[model samples]
Target: MLPSIGMALVLLFSMSGCGEEDRRGVLFKGVVAPPGIVMVAGGREHTLALMADGTVWGRGSNFYGELGDGTTLNSLTLVQTVGLGDVATIAAGGLFSMAVKKDGTVWAWGYNGFGALGDGTTTDRWSPVQLQGLSDVTTVSISGYHTLALTHAGTIWAWGYNARGQLGDGTIEDRLTPVPVAGLTNVVAVSASTSGQYSLALKSDGSVWAWGSNSSGELGDGTWLERSTPAPVQGLTDIVSIAAARRHGMALKRDGTLWAWGANYYGQLGNGTRTSTRAPVKVQEPSGVISLMGGEDHSVALKLDGTVWTWGVNDQGQLGAGRDDIDSVIPLKVLRLTEVSAISAAWTHAMAMKQDGTVWAWGLNNRGQLGDGTTTNRNIPAEFLGL
Candidate 1:
């Protein structure tokens, strides 16, 4: 869920009267951050942070203008995403960035090869642009080449690549503009696989619905057939949250139990086995989970105790278990981290936000996504300065 719209507006107005010099302190908003990160989003090779002041910042790869700084140059240090303020929440896709403003309008920028920007075009944007035909939007989710918007009225709108029907419009046709998702209503939250071939929605009744590429069982319907429309996941109820990865899916029950299905070649299922399944399987250890995230081939869980655990492929130290060349079939506690408030995982890197509002990252840093001011990878968690 996203932060309240009212609070975001309050913060934005409170800092609206600052002087020019004070505004110059922060590159994008022109106002210095209030020393805390309220939210974070991870992309394939970049990351975004939303400050307590309702401003957004980006770092790492900007090859496709994913950084949203009006340039394609990547930065190791944080650069404010120009023209974004009063943002309620932010999401990062494979090579794009999205934000929901306090006014309930959605904005997007970056790679739009398949019209992921939803602005009726396929041109990449170097800075934020108001997404056409969308308003009263509560949240936005982006994947490899598509996006989803959930409006306050409980309607879900989709656009972009639909080769595998990830758009959920009951068709395999790509859309350059927002299209209503067929037959889905009362959706409280939605998620799209970072790989862009599948999607999931959690309804008000706590039932999970899936669509798109079911190959590798990503749809969790006990079938490998692809879906052009929404279908109920087998045997899942009381689910509070859902996450989709490259070829897998995960759900967090209200009781803090984590369930995984789909691809398990690398044990992303976290069920103490490397075998894949078409049905949901219980994840091992640290049951009091409050949130969960999945990467290309790994998974992460944030327990109520504020500790983080990770499993699956660690070839790039994405698991943050002090090793980078091995895989863990079961969950392992991340080294030297605690008091975590939120977590995000991309294809090969992961990030955690401590209660103090400081962000930490580890794993692949070839594009400097780690934000530690270096391209060197860390086998253990490292503090990311500049909030």
Candidate 2:
């Protein structure tokens, strides 16, 4: 049985925010934690922290109480995502969020205007509510208006907006609950972006599948037609990790090569041109990238040497460089950032955590989403305090 949201908060403190050791920047290098902790960009206005103790902490925007802190309040301090025993993973959308527990149970919270919560109702949940009939959800991808989950058995389940067939259920009907995506199995990773109204999954065999909206060729099927079913992304064989942007998609191969497709109005595709491609094209970066993340109109990459690189729209200086007007067509190094553990990008904003346990943010700060206790937009990256 689920405990009351209040008691869950009390028990949550010890489990969720208990780990406060100074990370010498080698958490992944040592055997202390699992290898290559997954990082999702544009997932939430605030990031989700799913600790090993089965608890979740969220720090960022909470307009809809998506933080799962049992109140419709914004928190600068890390607050419990849920008062659950232990959570395995977490996925956050624009307004709603979901988590998979260690026991294969699923929980959801926040906005349900279109039934994104998957609780068999359209009512918004301020606190985490157990999802019905979903077990062993290994990973979840939350888009602007939809949600997708990959089960332990390799089956893909989808819910929320179907206006653009982003749900991939062979129909344009929005789902209030989980529905299986047809003709897909043995999937290793799943991701959804904000704009494209589509989803991508990389199978265990190094092949790529794309479905949903394709108006701007976000599906990378060489056609502008929308697909409600899974289709192969052309020229993208042997891909290992994939990322979706608001209007474009990018993938990284096992060979440390990066590829991009779809919308390129602001040079996000990094192909040294502003033209959009309907098929996968290699991103023309000279560096070997280990991690890649995309935001509303910008992208950030982590090179093999622990340095951060950024490109695309820098209207808000999301590139983390000191100058705002200087836009680079190619990847440029973000200054004052080093030994970074991970980085994430949001709308007109970028954030990173260092190996020394400090967090920094740059770009749009309209709602104080940067968490630096200031509403001023930063052209260069600034330190975020009070964590």
Candidate 3:
């Protein structure tokens, strides 16, 4: 039986009553993109920008023309994603990109080394190509070497690296096309860490499932064993959302609490220490968290009160607090910044959109991913321009 979802009606242009409309299609249980931005927090070598009109802009690390800018030439400037409009969300892998259109179609570009493009070919594309054989895609998630999609019909599909069964097809052979993730049904959303070697699934009933590499207990099943198929993350239920990083995972409980597990070498787990955990542990934060993003070495959370909190590695100033000395093991407030409505993190930098439609960025700027008109790193959040 399909899980029952409570519905609330929300007006798109109005902040109040947003929950009403937000829950409209919850019953269908399709792919759920990471809140706000689509790029993996620290896995994306490029930056993805979403315009007000639903167009997308991408720049940086186009090693394979992953930017979908029609050129392999690396871009330090924003290049509008060609041939796409009415996009609802966008994501980038190591050298590939994906976007879910407003009409539920998925588009991809860049390297197809392992068939990550899901276009039924190994040919790399310098321009956007619509994914073959599926529609009603609600969310698209990309990792360093793979891709995953969730459809409105409550099914999941994956492509790319399968060396460790990361593709979850019970095989170690890589695929050059999309393949169904066996045994999963009524799935609401799917997430892949930057590595594309493990995954998490959120079902319609608010339960979480995991597969792929579990050497570090990232699967959250209480045992560090690799799973070739979906397995429930022990004791985890009623999850509203989930996200993954290189070796860490995080989820927001239905009641607005945040929990994390797996790698914490840089304190990405938000437990006030660098110790690794094998199971979900509550993140130490003072406010109720509405959403969470797990970066390669840091984590960000959007609070119910419109404030943003960050923790983990500050080596590249990814924490956006104007100093690299404070490696926040616990959620600390970002100063001089407020009214943030959405946040996205790239390989090293982070972008936050304000309630007024302005964007702000901070952290590593070596590749000009920060879009602040320069390549120099900024330790504090700075306004972004060029739309």
Q: Give the best candidate by TM-score.
A: 1
Query: lDDT, candidate 3, residue 176?
Result: 75
Q: Write the per-residue lDDT of candidate 1 for residues 79-192, one digit (tens) a residue.
A: 888899999999998888999999999989988887889999999999999987689999998988889899999999999999999998999999999999989999999999
Residue pairs with clashing backbones, model 2: 54-86, 54-87, 195-246
lDDT tens readout by residue for model 2, 121-203:
88888889998889888878786567888888888999887777888889988899989988999998888776527998889
Q: Determine the C-alpha RMSD for candidate 1 after optimal superposition of all C-alphas.
A: 8.0
lDDT of 3 by residue, 1-387 (tens): 111111111123223454422432232234221223322222355677766567777656565767776755555566666788888878877667888898888999887877888888888898899987778888888887778899989998888877767778777778777788889899988988766779888999988888889877788888888877788887788998898777888888988888888888888888888888878988887457777776667888888777778888888788888797568888877766788777776655677777876678888776566777677787788876555
Ranking by lDDT: 1, 3, 2
Q: What ranges in model 1 sit over 4 Å off?
A: 1-34
Runs with alpha carbons beyond 4 Å of true place in candidate 3? 1-43
Worst 10 residues of 1 by lDDT: 4-13
Score each candidate by Cα lDDT: 0.87, 0.73, 0.75
Worst 10 residues of 2 by lDDT: 2-11
| Candidate 1: residue pairs that collide | 23-30
**142, model 3: CA deviation in Å?**
0.5
- Stronger candidate by lDDT (1 vs 2): 1
